[model samples]
Target: MRTLRRSTRGRIGRIDSRDAKTGIGAAELPALAGGRIERVSVAREQDSVASRFAERIREEEELRLSPLAARSYPAVRVRPEEDCALRTPFQRDRDRIVHCKAFRRLTHKTQVFVAPRGDHYRTRLTHTLEVTTISRTVARALALNEDLVEAIGLGHDLGHPPFGHIGEEVLDSCLKERFGEDFRHYEQSLRIVDELERDGMGLNLTEPVRDGIVRHSSRAPLPETLEGRIVRVIDRVAYINHDIDDAVRAGLLREEELPREPIEVLGSSGSARIDSLVHDMVEHSATAGDIVQGPRAGPAMAALRDFMFEHVYLGPAVRAEHAKISSVIRRLFEHYVEHPEQLPRDLAGGDGTAAEDVASRVTDYLAGMTDRYCIRRYTELQVPQAFAR
Candidate 1:
């Protein structure tokens, strides 16, 4: 018979070796031994800590949240199976958005500039972070649900196609021409979380988070929750200021060239502008009991947005690049529609649906691609490369 021995590793009751001839089961050895076996309660301790922290957070929300703030205790969409012991619904939503493949793709997607030569230019992911920062600042000031606001901000642009709005426009045009369907990024964002993510399993996000994501664009209706509303406002605030900074960096616009009235009212620089806008938003929204900008600051920000559209967004240099990007997107879209089999297996439509369904799937797959990925795919399909010997 082999002598039984215990190893003094981090875990307790770990059998060091098996005695095959002894006919003793490893698990039964502890019970069989006259000696007492001690079990480490690590999992129990961790669960206790997590449960206590979660309870404390709930208590904090009940005590500290404003009357207008969204509460996490009773989420609108309850998925008992998906509920977390450690995180609130909104917190879970934020984590899901952060960990998602779409969010990861944002790192290489266009924000304002498409594949800018300089590394300092912001990508879609950086822009999302900035928006979340600005939204949380406002939400915290209002004593609102910062978690909900953050989730919305982080996910607002998840469906934006490569090459920024230009790519969106090209895809929309192709879809319209082929299937008479429109491709709106905000709508696509909702689709991403609801259906396209996690191998078609979706994120199972909360109602408020989904509402905020779909309505983050100014063109959409206002969100029901004040937390969502905060993100809706801050999304514009982040992009306008950051786009200005990028435009300046790209030598597309100078500080002096920016519209004087809006600059004077908002601020002279990007950081100053964001600070001013955030302060104005907090002050006005607090007073009105709704998320809004001050009388003066609102118009100034609008003017700034208009200025960007005319200069940085639709300017000659950007328009030139937009033409090239539009061509790539349009060609790829058309090629895929013509040869549906070329699409990845998932997008090739095994559902026995109409051609329109295949077209929609193609649009979803293409829209999710990053800027560099789209360019590379286009080059691979369209450009003739020499075959290696």
Candidate 2:
């Protein structure tokens, strides 16, 4: 139990928790004894176990005064708190998501294509995978917390409605009218993971992850650390390029129609374009004086984003379908509100129905939809399905 002085992570020494910094949960959360540790890994680890795990003291002298360098919040109180064999924060997050019902439901959620489409057409599951990879890589490169970024990536879309953004917008509108409160997917994702996941067990994810999920909208959070910023940027990069590909497949827009800037600066295809954009953002952010460049990239990227918004997002083909989908969800909300018996066994006799019946039913039903199910429900309500499930 000799104290070692080193420049690496996971080192044992007398460090104030207020000034404590360890690598995000690649190894394990530093024990909360507030004194010393045996073997810990910095979120930044080198190759050697003894050196990487070799104790480094983060005494107050080495600590940075900035908010970005602050220690992570204490881990959530999950089960099996043996004190000795505790899970790493990342492992806990992984387990929490696996056990949650919402994570399971992602299999049927839309990424762009509907259910039962070609297996490769990015279900919400595949989309999460892509985001996770992109987020992790960026975090690692930035020397940011990979565990927090990974957790955020996994939990980002947890609140997406049954048919993806289409379903989310429909539900938001339907619920807003009933309750006079908007139901954003970002907020809903947080609410679902916080209030509805695991029979209301909630994911109880870390603060950093929750912030990413809550602020994964057009208005990105002023991140406390680089990891969060990476997640936010990678998210936009992943969605825009993937959406373009999806639109191309759906014949909503041709690849040739993409704006010249993003195409020329990035590339013309899906993967290439994503890589290019990610690199540009990362490189720009990593450079001295340009590290964040957050507000700076706005003008150039905003114009391209607007072009996509005009040419691809609101294009006749997609909105035409949105109208049909919206009508379907709206009708279902009306039906289930009047007749609560049709709702699942779990939702009856709750405060949700008592206060806002229509919004509650819409939330309940929409939360369970597969891509095809949303479509089928729409058909059933409007045209009467010949073979109803």
Candidate 3:
């Protein structure tokens, strides 16, 4: 009987030198001298649908997607992982963002209006969906990677705090005054995905998705990928038009009050304006080989944006609530600052950690709250139990 020997790797060694020369492993050797074959398999794994699915998507993307479009095959995650059987990297990223707890909290967070009584008003979650829809439409027209665009669009505003921009503004001010640091929703969004989510392990999202989320704002640096660029531009397009609809519905602005010249150049209604803008963007970006808007529609959109800021965004209607929102945020900030033990254990470092670190944790906790939750917590802290009930 042939004796079996173990290799240095703890695997079965070749039965003889002849098997090594032939490149055959011990598994294939026939039994001899009345010994049964062990049949230790040594062949490479066979190709199948599960193994080839992602590669097929990459090949299809190479054929149909724009030359400048980002590819998902070579996904760059902060931590490496195995490829999914069915979803491309960006598709997987979209799934992760959708499933995460932060994304769910968006439903109760403010968009333009803070806690509107009417159900039709857009919340942060709806805004995200709108941006993703518009971005996908533009991406499809441009032959860009729609999956990447969708992922970026969905994640771009995940960092926005409750009470809309008012909450963000107060939080920023509180941080600067108390800790000599500043806060921005975009930066916080990056931190959430990189360090805060999943009880501090983050989402482990791909590099492109993370980049698109943090750079979707015009105030931030431009994104590296064309898909991210699409989201950056479309976010404004989605918000400006939707905010107008919401404003009119809230009786804060009349459709006729819109700037005449810009209205004529773009369109009278929100849908018409979006259509004109999308068409202009498609034509201009195709020619420029980058996401851009034509002169007329570009200036028209900008004019509309300016008009919104003056009348709807920063105007009397919304500003009236500013003081109330500010008080809620500042009071909460001070309360947490004086009592770091109230922070979640994951965010709160050890007792020996720096005060600045604790302040940062407070910021994260507050920023993650929904609009109603923020107000509820504020009431619970400030109001007498009899009055609160």
- Model 3 poorest ten-residue lDDT run: 39-48
lDDT of 1 by residue, 63-180 (tens): 8999888888776663445458778888989999899999999999998787789989999999999999988988898899989988999999999999898888889898999899
Task: Provide TM-scores for the models.
Answer: 0.87, 0.73, 0.87
Q: Rate the local accuracy (lDDT) of all candidates.
A: 0.84, 0.63, 0.86
Residue-by-residue lDDT tens digits, candidate 3, 174-292: 99999999889999888888888787788899999999999988989999999999999988998999999999999999999999998999889999999999999999999798999
Q: Look at candidate 1 and tell me the lDDT of residue 209.
A: 95
Any runs in candidate 1 off by more than 4 Å, and if so which?
Answer: 1-42, 50-54, 78-82, 348-353, 387-389
Per-residue lDDT of 7 in model 3: 43
Clashing pairs in 2: 10-40, 11-55, 11-56, 23-42, 23-43, 285-291
Residue lDDT tens for model 2, 1-389: 22233334434444332423543332445543456664565533444423432122123313422234323334434332321123445556756775677777888887754442355566887788788898877665655556677777888777788766777777878777777767777777787767676665666676666777788666555555566666666776777777777777767777778777656656667888666666666676665422253443444456566876787666665566687677777888767766666677564235444656546545755766766677676677767456654
Worst 10 residues of 2 by lDDT: 52-61
**After aligning candidate 1 to the native by TM-score, how far in Å is the CA of 349 from where it should be?**
4.9
Scored by Cα lDDT, where does model 2 land? 0.63
Instruction: Identify the superior model by lDDT, candidate 1 or candidate 2.
Output: 1
Candidate 3 yields a Cα-based lDDT of 0.86
Candidate 3 — which residues are off by over 4 angstroms?
Answer: 1-47, 348-353
